[model samples]
Target: MSDTLWWQHGVVYQIYPRSFQDSNGDGIGDLEGIRRRLDHLCWLGVDAVWISPVFPSPMADFGYDIADYRGIDPIFGTIEDFDRLLAEAHARGLKVILDFVPNHTSDRHPWFLESRTSRESPYRDWYIWHDPAPGGGPPNNWLANFGGSGWEFDAPTGQYYFHSFLKVQPDLNWRNPAVCRAMYDALRFWLDRGVDGFRVDVIWLLVKDDRFRDNPPNPAWQPHEASINRLLQVYSADRPETLEVVEEMRAVLDEYEERVLIGEIYLPLERLMAYYGRDMKGAQLPFNFQLIFTAWNAAAIARIVAEYEAALPPGGWPNWVLGNHDQKRIASRVGRGGARLAAMLLLTLRGTPTLYYGDELGLENVAIPPDRAQDPWERNEPGLGLGRDPARTPMPWDAGENAGFTTGRPWLPLNEDRAERNVASLSADPDSLPHLYRHLIALRRGHAALSTGDYVSVATEGEVLAFERRRGGVRLLVALNFAQSPARLALPGDVAGADLLLSTQPGRDTAPVTAEWQLGPEEGVVLALR
Candidate 1:
């Protein structure tokens, strides 16, 4: 990490506002709700917070389909509420980053509304539109990420508007300079209001193939509730033209000091790095999602980590994520016990670590019953299980009515056993997940080796992951047993004397220094090397 860029070294906590806190008693969270939790964030010692979108929307996609670029949705609160939240965040010494959706807009947006009314409208070309095929079908064989054709037909204009997601979210025409300027202006609107940065959504889909070509069929069908991941979306998304737009956005960010832009790109590592731009003037951080895809094993994670560090461009920063609203919770994905090991690595890793809202309490996604499903993707395609409602459920703050989220019924059901896993309960227990998180975060903050150090993989084998973090002359080794039984791992030949830092092994004081160390089931240990 650069000494000048201190923000690059600390932890980042991601808050999905709708589920974080409910201040208005409407059973839905708002900006004011977030404002009330500034102290909690400060106590966690995170340097910044990345909020999911709170922009005006029709709720079709739960605020992802932005309807107004410069206004807050009524459900969240007014512009005044946002100002209060921003002020409180800064007061607590937390930098704020908003979710910026640049690739598409809600169908109900004024621009889209006008564009769809007539072909000659000035905004008609603001979005990608195409005529129907000879057989009265979609212009191409491209499929929506949420299922069905990516293009939605409009009978009035005899044309189809492209939507990479739901039909209601039409893709913006990045080819138009006006669209680029408009989105850039939107970023300025918030930056002017004291926002520290932005997290660009679906950034890889900002542009498309100039020739309206068909995406080839995907032979492997991995069914999710929204859409089948069977088709190769080559022409539909991750186009080469996307980088030009990123450069333009980065230029706008450059005008403001310390304003950062991060992007969400699901492409393979090689292609994902391209979003950073060849000139290294695009998004400040292209989210490293290897942990989300790789299996929970020492060798697998070590190899992926090595590959990602090697793949980064010179001077570019790296970021890591364990969970997001779009996917299953880290606990659910990597098993309940695996969550602790994952958290340790996330906080101690050599990057800007992003912690999902309730991850500190080891929150798992609540299982949503079919009748109560809220995600549009689930509603549109019943056969596929791509819906995100499981991970978007409300947070459990206390063991009280509505999990202390609200006085009334929540929009989504809380975990039935939330009383046992609530923050209030965990905060009282010395050995709770929340306490572990605080210890690890504090340790990371206090030790330079854990925060901005050069990461070196320590040699180990058999269900044990070990690595050494070094900065200046300080070096520390951290290891975790990821299996269900005791595993003996041999340390690298270079290791001499090591002082124990923290260990989850029961009844263990200091682990005996041997060529081989035995780790209990689902246990972790940290040591200072001499």
Candidate 2:
């Protein structure tokens, strides 16, 4: 691994605060809840923790809609609580990365309040605002991710502002230099208070088409109830000018020693790599969601992995994600029984891996009843089932009344099977998924080939998956079976001196220079090259 970059050295854990823990009896999670679980995170062997936004918000979009860039939400806790959480995390030898939402702010934010108060307010031009069309409708036909037109009418100002997401989230005008500087200053404030880095939110949307032209029609639109994916998101996101802002953000991180920034970009592999900026001056690691978004097959995964590796520019780091608050958990996506295999693959990959909270224990999405759903995507339109509430369910720590997440009613219910999957129970079982993750992470850290290695696609056929990770004089071979029946794979090359490092099943002698080996259904193994 490179000596200059700490981000390149290890894994990052992403914690969605609302579901992590609830310290108060109010049923909502707080920083104190997170502070109490530092030891658990440390024990999992993650190098750093990337926390989701805790900024003050109207809760219009859960915590994504920011009302104040610099203050913590009262529901999450005060600034003092954040300081305490940071101090505790550092004491536990864990780095802390805060979520920075710079693309837009809640309509209730003071900047927007003043901007909407008058057409001449200094903050009026800070956001993207334009007069309605001749027909008294939006300026353009761009659609919001949450289902309506991207432009919202403000009666007071008689103008419409761009919002790629929820209407409450008005897009910021990054073309305005003052807005750029202000966002950068907010980032610096967090760094000065001891944050190790940031996970920049929707970074590619910061810049838009200067002409405000209508987006071309999307040929790929397949509506899920009322999703706006039907229309192409041309003018709203992934604009070229966004790269300039990324470079500027990178410069800000460079000002502070050891400060890192990762971007959440949802573009295709080709466009996503641009977030690294020219010559690697953009994000330290732009998130790779291929593992989550693409089909789960050996050939498909192999092709995507190869494509991502080829897309990265020199000096740029790569990161992989399997699940997050926005999507279904990996265990649920694959099969509940395949959770350990998924962990092995994620940890053993050749990049920084981000493990979402509750994923370690095979947590599945909550089946939210229609009446209790809290997500705007679901609440805005009934029966669409677009709400992320199912995936954003509360974490299961113990088999207590509320899964040990809180003393009061949980903001979200724990899975009824929590009795079997809770942390306290899983930690006791030697073969539990959580224990498997711990072992897999330790194995990755022990082998240099697993961390910063060059990945080689090993030729194999049938229900078996195989690959080689090599760096310097080290090489490790990884293989997994996807079928229910035993699958045998022919060794790619002479493996006369390979030694077993880790295997899903026990009491198997895997030596003596055999040209073929058998793997049970969903089985995985790592072979250390001699």
Candidate 3:
């Protein structure tokens, strides 16, 4: 609120474009649909909207396998539609962050198409192509995240090209200066088109092991885990030279003012911090996803907060993510009641918090039947339950057919109970989860201590998570109960004058706490310390 960077203090809401809202009768969400839904984001109090890719694609991996970096897919609309969306979003005082897939391109991409035509093509070096192993197998032991070998043979060139995810999405050669320059120009194209920032996709995988070393097996990987986790990916991702690519992208972003860069990396806290770049020049928000992996226990969460806080490089700002298109929803993972506590933790934490598209309404993972399952990963490996379709269901806008997301059938099914889980229905009930989210967001915005203050973990009893946020003379104590059974926490200080600013439970606020407090099951409260 006081000259702080907007992204450093504001909340980011991610929108999976295809499922957010479908404007036409096409069953897929378009930019116009997103334009119509800006009011919903405004009501939710999000400062910025980070949209997943809507670029032209072959749908091999949904929008992740980008075919044209500069053009919008026909299903999503045209360049003019995007321009209008950007203008409308900014008009509503919301920043728009586009998903930038720099690691790879669709096999249908013109560059990739020409590159595979022959090894002598000028664009051949734009993608990673390698000769097969002596035994005529994959280049090495690298495996595609989606499944199978990462290398796909090209009969014409008599070589194999690398793909980190799907064979349809070929990895780009960041080692080639020309490729890096082309990607930078693509970023410049969007910046010129007035995009506020980019959420760089799989940024850690930008550079790879130059020597083509085989990845070591993951000793802790379980059979139930996705096949990609069988190997640790140490050589395939997070390479030492990845920083070079990060620096180059950061330079491109730096040319624009008041823009942010967020990187989606799945690494431990130690290695994750490196994306902040030397001298704090990497991604503006390198996405602290510890919560996604941390066990849902009070002490465990407290340790995560402490360790993650400690892990922040000097001058690096912290951020948190609870759910995304790739992972299970917080509500489904933690159960219905636990989502309230999650919202409290996500909003009150000492950093920028990214709220996934529909988590506010307690949206859970919907079961996609075999007949309607659309995710490529799930189709590629049907039995592993590795599909993301469950998490990418259409948003529930109202108690109408198709949840009012689309006039016709939705691309993905709505939450089965969309009648009562819709936004309009929840907005009518003051005690609904989305309203609680709004309360927490407003509380964070109005209180500097809650937004950007120093986080001090306070002592708490079993299953109780308590922390104090202090900014100058303002100190706010936030206490939460993670379990279903009620628990009492000893007051850490003279709480005789402390005021309950907000509470997860309805009709429990603006009151004084006694020497000891009884916290309702799955309850969280923010108190103003006098």
- Which prediction has the highest TM-score against the true structure? 3
- State the TM-score for model 1: 0.97
**Cα error of candidate 1 at position 37, Å:** 1.2
Q: Give all candidates' CA lDDT scores.
A: 0.86, 0.85, 0.91
Where does candidate 2 have its weakest 10-residue lDDT segment? Answer: 505-514
Candidate 1 backbone collisions, by pair: 218-230, 224-384, 224-385, 224-386, 225-384, 225-385, 225-386
Q: How many pairs of residues collide in each model?
A: 7, 0, 0
What's the ranking of the predictions by lDDT, best on top? 3, 1, 2
Q: Which residue runs of candidate 2 sit more than 4 Å off their true CA positions?
A: 1-4, 506-513
Local error of candidate 3 at residue 183 (angstroms): 0.6
lDDT per residue for candidate 1 within 212-317, as digits (tens), equals: 8888877775553235467788888888888988888989989999888889989899998888897789888888888988989988988888889898888777
Best by lDDT: 3
List candidate 1 segments past 4 Å from native.
1-4, 222-228, 504-515
Candidate 1: 10-residue stretch with minimal lDDT: 221-230
Give candidate 3's TM-score: 0.98
Cα lDDT tens digits, model 2, 340-400, are: 6788778887889999998999888889877778888887766776778888888889888
Candidate 3 lDDT over 249-295, as tens digits, reads: 99899999988989999888899999999888889899888898789
Off by over 4 Å in 3: 494-496
